[model samples]
Target chain A: MSTKDNPSESGRRNFFKLAAAGSLGALMASTPLKKVLAQVQDPEKPATNIADALKIPKTETSMPGKFPGKVVKVFDAQSVVEDKPVKTAAYQMLSDAMLQLTGAATLSEAWLMFVQPHEKIGLKLNPIGGKLLSSSHEVVQSVIEQLLEAGIPKENIVLWDRREFQLHEAGFTADAYPGIAITGTEKKDADGSYYNKEGKLYSEEMIDKDWFYFADVDGEYDDYTLPYMVNAGKYSYFTKILTQDLDKIINIPILKNAGSSITLCLKNLGYGVITNTGRLHAKLWGDTSAEVCCFPPVRDKVVLNVVDGLRGCYQGGPGANPQYICNYNTLLVGTDAVAVDRIGYDIVLKKRIEEGIQQEDSPRGRQFMEYAAQLGLGEADIEKIDLVEVIK
Target chain B: MKNTLILFLFLFAGNCFAQQPFVLRDDVLPDITSVNTRLFDKDGLWGYINGGADLYLEYGFEQVTVFDIKAGGIDYKADVYRMASPEAAFGIFSISRFKCQESARITPDDCLTPYQYIAAKGNFYFSISNSSGSPEAQVHLLAIAGNLLEQIENLSIEKPSLFNYEMLGPHLSGLKYISGQLGMQNGFVRWEPLFQQSKNYTAWIMPVKQDGSIFYVALVDFSDSADMETFMQKNGLTASNGLNQVVGNKIYTLFIKQNNRLVLTEGVIPESLRDYLEKF
Candidate 1:
């Protein structure tokens, strides 16, 4: 056993102290703690150092890319037929949406606008829902096919997420997309070990220590959470794949709800690119979703947002609950993440209202979008967005 | 006498540290392939469900044991959560279960959907799921849930005291128990603004229909008078001698606060519903 695998003596002492004070349960329970430990470094409420993220200079290709407030919504009833996605319909829908979005004469021209043959492109997908309600293979294949047709080499294109195993579980495999590199930050070896021979986490090396979202809020994780988080403290390091490997990122998130709010483009990119995200979700879910994108890695690299709504959950989601899953049969493409999410929120909210799940809109549901807009991420106000809808 | 006292203390401590049995034996369920159990406590819950842990933890989570089993040529994943209280267990169960296809034959409290079976019994809430949503898989899912339920000594599933009202019996399935903002957001979001103003309060909310109209009734119990007072003040309301009927923003609010408990009804209330609310 390596020393890195175990908590330091001081760390163990602090954990036990927190356990005795009932802070551990309170923190995990999301209960506001009144008692403050003078010696403890962790704050009662989550507070990330957004100042560091803001220091990075923004490029011309920074978020709200090419088309800022423009969102192209393409809905084909045949996109998902009887709970399954139609490959032909998916390809047609993507082609139509991209063409309309870029006003390109051809599909290749539209693809070329986002990426060049020389640049390494990354496809960030939401595969957390497994096979039941993940990003459909039809849509992913269509995106890859379009990229291939645009003269990008197969080796230059990568399909990735936070969890490698989940990406495989969702059927994003070597057999499926042979030449494209499929990878993740948190990966296990052939022997199913998340740790290397020296017992350091394989994910530990995958993180870039220099770049981190340093929050005043410290995370004290147990053994189980440590493997996923890689490290615990005030720092949440960005994955090397986002920081070092990829040049241009195309975010493909599933259209789903995380509570009242929709986890569309911003949520997927923000949470996916970093480590120690569990602490952020408790108090700063909206903040993390918005502020993490302000960093150069996410802000500058991510060029496009394509939401797979072909088969998504309208109610009980971000997780796949079969009953709540619906055939949205829709695809939303945009350069402005916030605009696409705003339009997606309206669609999901309308479904919730029509199903009698909710009577009226909750102000809290649109909070992340508002935060993202305020941070200069994109357009959050529906009135300001130029929505072009195509019904096929 | 001192030695005897020391021995008794050791026995009690040993019993306290004893593990909760989380396996389905061959005798209990025949033709089981294997059971792989994983335990999560406090912060460890983050690994189990990622961000979804917050909602469960907010409802006073203690610990959870997950069983990944291969049984009868079918893959089954079962999660058993031990919450702080029975109300906490039910609160999580209420928010998670949706559009139930039928009630599990094992217990009326269990909700059986096509791909999942969820139940809250005593201070424990558990869900068993299979990827295949076929009827064959559903049968095994219920059986696994039933066997797990039997192992739990406490089988009581108690509803809030307000449920004693006969008028709410028909809408029992729609009833939700909320503990915090996350629960408020997921279960009964319309009342999130009102609840956001206060803390240390648990609410039982339900929607009722009368004469082509829908209204919401929320029964809140605050941990202390200060919280209740703060909630009333923030929402701009005064505790009158009896039920105070306030009409604002095209919605009707009829509420009464006594000590730490408040029963409020909101939305477009008709004459008959108002009369019915007065009975409370």
Candidate 2:
């Protein structure tokens, strides 16, 4: 339903009035008020025309579907090596495939178009998997190299995640690659509070001497109340900083069969956008991971998605639970995040079936692609999408 | 048999008569005099004063009485100031006797207990006692008081904890709820970042639901009308027409769809005495 028809607005107004009155009877009556507010603020929005939103041109092969875009599958290779030579071969093959899919003249040009040079690019890397199941070093380096070749200066490109110490543990050097700089948000601010220099900080204008302003709305409604809105002194602000400065974002998600579900581009963006990533699970509405994935802050900022499938964990993931890593030697790149994730879902299903695992039995096997598609994020159907491969 | 019955009846009657005649005593209670002072007192308390002694009382609740000696022809007014409750119970009264004179200097320290006096300094503090005096119970009470007491009440205590002092101000303001979204840009001061090229565009609407209300806030990054029109057409979402005004570098469009109804009210308070309601 559209936000205009939301029942929570009046309910919230009532709640505020009752709260201001300090009346117990009013508070008791406001129970439904709270529920209605939660429902209206359910995070999910209609992803209608996402392909058009990303400026994906209409093609003859594009079929009419319930969702906004289509998912295309390219190549699925098993038993690939992780060393430099093997990784280069895999990337070259993947890059060629992406070039063909995008209809660009060269791989570099396609990469440039996908990630515009003038815009400040935030490459959100999924590093929670540590060294073993994180975004492959080869994939990250290749993208960086491609951006550098496309004339995107090193300073404008920021390789970021939540923690810098974790990146160091995973063997990433502290070198500033001329044009591209790498850092995390755990550094100290001048005011003694921690600062996330690259991402969106809590607006300083909202902070009073003791109390801080936290709005679920755009700060326009008079029904505003400060319930969970903590006083600034009472709580330390831990902000997701990278989102603030960047004009555009390229999400590099490792293809892993998450214990919770598929950890694809949507999960990557959703988790990366919020300071408290763990709180998503605590939300009462079922499948908080999927719900939070649809938030405008993360969903709107994402310009492109590139899924690393060269070596994937098909069984357990989002941090190696072991018995899940499988070499799939694939790279799925697309502007449509939902479509890219849908294809990733198919790859996971294929691996699960090959290993004699029941797709319905696994948590990661749950059909989020369908739900995401219903939300207008992308197309789950393969018949409408045109897939082209260039392998050397 | 008749004699025995008569004797039984008499015993019963005598028992009933003994239960009678319980009367509330009507003796003249101590006349409590009101003084313009900042002390707390109730009934059943008296203050003693000596002649030619200096005394001062700030205003709240204080009592004064005069004692005269006929032989010496000397009259003196004894000032009694009601101190705060020793055990921290509300409405329980205590008093301190002060000798009255023409002019006297009184500080908060003289009227309040050392801990209470320091707490009155508008700072947050907690008391830690090393002695073997009900440590667990006292610690709990101190913690409760730390959370509950206002800044004015805290001025009476001495040596309040620094951490508690820092926490007090913010804790009182409470949490604020806000709702809004990011949507279409109407204009730009400079072509930078998201607006790199002449027609670069991006915008979003976050119709935030807060405190049982909905507020529509739009964040837009493009100034081109054509781009905005295309965006509106592509998304199947309508734009708030005529909201093209730009303030500074950012453009803001605000429209309130609903008002919050939750009102805070003191149910039992009398309307005439609303000014003193915060004190409660």
Candidate 3:
């Protein structure tokens, strides 16, 4: 058969041509026409087929020089009452399994590595999803208790979200833990000043001056605007308080189906740093989303990524309507934000398939996962990932 | 022949429809309650008087009209002359800084600075002068009466102008008028005059405080839009969609109908007038 009719012969010729060239740089330069020829020849390793004799670089791990290992720990357990499988028992089992993965003898050792003893750890939770599809209270309180037991002072721990009123509506109270506190950026002190004003809580200030400084002087929203920054002058983007005191941040986000693809660690950080986050929604576009996500303030600041997947929201989430919540009984943790979100995209896809939903119909099912992967954020291929599961 | 006539008539009607109305209202001065009420309080120093003695006249001829004035409290002054023509009334006011000790002294160069020109005819005080360096100042103009020394304090400056007019009707209160210099970028003064209709012409006036100083006020009739547009263009103003609607092709004229009134007073231009002139 002619080489055109025999696909295997064409593949062999392309492979030898690439091999004889010795390097991808030489091959691409020598036979520019072979660029299209390389794509169809290797189906399994297409990204590698374009280049030859070059090994793909290993993914970067949290600890430098160490290969990235499985960061998630899952456990299997039976329910006490229903005599059926209980997810909460699985959570407790996974908590133990996490200690083994990290090579720590106890939970305290694991937490010590999770949060340093001297650090004032801010546990940023997502309550925007309301109670059902939010960061579980049990998981949050468990992490808070773990930090306290690991020698981080109770006063050094604060459970924070964007709005205090919403946190209260979602069932967190000031009086719940006296030493260990739960507060939002909007909390007021005894003197009635905002807790986060003038670089107090977060370092970066809100952009639009009219919302805070001008609105206060005009006495527009007298109750909310005046008492907070009444005498305080205008603050610029450089005047945020959280940047000063925070040495590290623990991002506890819920894995949810978002309108802008998977809302996980990246979206959680988007809401955390800026004051006028609604501006993001008003000017939404594909490049705008990536630009805002990769803005300097967010890209460098987030150090830990802990996604709560015990009860996932797999459809039309990041907004709490009753239809999206699913009991996946998984808790995922990784220092690589992109990796954690990559796994989140997979969970969303699997859940959609189980419900007989088309991938194209799901907003979170798009190729942004591969785009984010190509941007060096994480690995999209399941085969390249080392997933670890445990049972009790 | 009937069809041709109908077509000609139709074209003429369409041409007439394309012409827009002149003298459109632009931005309204914010209705600050206290300032508005004080401007109209007839029972107070700002009110109109029927007739009065040379009642507290410090200088000039006898027949004086008493009007109460208040900045924070009550004061009194006489109404000198209400101008018969709208074109001659004008006034200027501004807040700025004095750069040197010679800054307040009137020289040809003094007119180059916005602050010095305003100070030449009015009391200028350094609100934050270092004396060691150039200091910022806030200046106010007092209406000049015949006697330079007897002009009431800055508080009673508006008294003389307010009492001279009689109201024709309540709707006349909304007829807004302004006066300022025509061509000088750094040498313009602005004022709003109150007017009530009379039998022959629209009677309007601006107050002058003659406390040994001279200031300029001008009046222009806002009725002719073409005159206003010409004046704005000569003064280096270009047509703005906003000012074009407010003053373009509208017929207005200026006149001086008061005595001891500050000279160099030009017609009042709209605040939006600068935007039109600035394009040139």
Candidate 2 C-alpha lDDT tens digits along B93-157: 11111111111112222212211211222221111111111324333223323322321232332
Q: Against the hidden reference, what TM-scores do the models get? A: 0.86, 0.42, 0.41
Native-vs-model 1 lDDT? 0.79
True contacts kept of 3: 0.00
lDDT of 1 at B45: 82
Look at candidate 1 and tell me the lDDT of residue A273. Answer: 92
What TM-score does chain A of each model score against the native chain A?
0.88, 0.66, 0.64
Candidate 3 TM-score, true structure as reference: 0.41
What is candidate 2's CAPRI-style docking category based on DockQ?
incorrect
Q: Report the C-alpha displacement of residue A177, candidate 3, in angstroms.
A: 2.9
Chain B TM-score, all predictions listed? 0.84, 0.15, 0.18
Docking class of 1: medium
- Cα displacement (angstroms), candidate 1, residue B175, comes to 2.0
Can you give the lDDT of residue B278 in candidate 2? 23
Candidate number achieving the greatest DockQ relative to the actual structure: 1
Candidate 2: tens digits of C-alpha lDDT, residues A1-392: 22343222232244344335543344225554344334434566322211111121223212122223533344544326432215565566556655665667987777665556666777878776555567777877777777777788777787776554445545554562445666564332445333246543323322222111122222111111111121112222222343245655677888986532477887776544433222222221123334444433344446667787776776535544222466777777776776777678767767766753322333323455555554445565666544444333
